[model samples]
Target: MKRTLTTFIATLALIALGAGARPAGAAGVTNAVAAAGTTNIVASSDGKFTPSTIVMHVGETTTLHLTSSGGVHGLVSNRLHIPLTRIQPGKAVNVAVTPSKAGTYVLPCAIFCGLNHANMKLTVIVKQ
Candidate 1:
């Protein structure tokens, strides 16, 4: 009886840990694509930026509407000319950006949220 109970508990613990484990290369994977002009970005306590990628044309202005669905977060990109922007729950912050060059810019979360913060990033693709 004792061995059976211990085995059951061990199996349960393994299942619980596996449930939170992500597949290899699954970090930062996003299927969402943001259009130009106006894009809405959502931050969460899970340390993720919704619509992880944004596509824009060079010389064209785009406004990023930043808001948090869970915890506080922030981002800043000097190459993209974006200033330090903070995102918090119950509030919205708008940032206007016009990419002069065409390239891919990866902006990581400026503020640390939690264990998954390193995987939190937004990819901006500027096209000529």
Candidate 2:
């Protein structure tokens, strides 16, 4: 009876751990417009930015809704005029950007996340 109980407890522990595990390379764009001019961007602990590429019009302001799925992250850009922003697991950070020039801007993760941190970047394409 004791052996059976121990096995049952072990199984439960394994299941609990698996529940929190996320698959690698499972990131995708979450660019659905939440509002009239808002774009959703999600960051994950796996070191990825969802909707890694976005398109914006020059002279038009767009709001980026940033959130983290598994870990704390940060973002900042001098060209885009975005301030240092913190993205937490359960909190949302909004950044408004208006591009004055037409070009492709790469915004990398401001904070080091993990092994895949170096590849984490968001590409913004601005057009007239």
- The top-ranked prediction according to TM-score is 2
Per-model CA lDDT versus the true structure: 0.82, 0.83
Candidate 1's C-alpha lDDT? Answer: 0.82
For model 2, what is the alpha-carbon lDDT of residue 4?
100
TM-score of 2: 0.74
lDDT of 1 by residue, 2-100 (tens): 999999999999997775463211222323345547787888889888878878889999988787767889999999999999988767788999999
Once fitted onto the true fold, the runs of candidate 2 whose alpha carbons sit more than 4 angstroms away are 1-34
The clash numbers for all candidates, in the given order, read 0, 1
Query: For candidate 2, lDDT tens digit of each residue in 1-128?
Result: 99999999999999977754532212234544456788888998888888789889999999998888878888898998989898887577789999999999999999888888898899999999
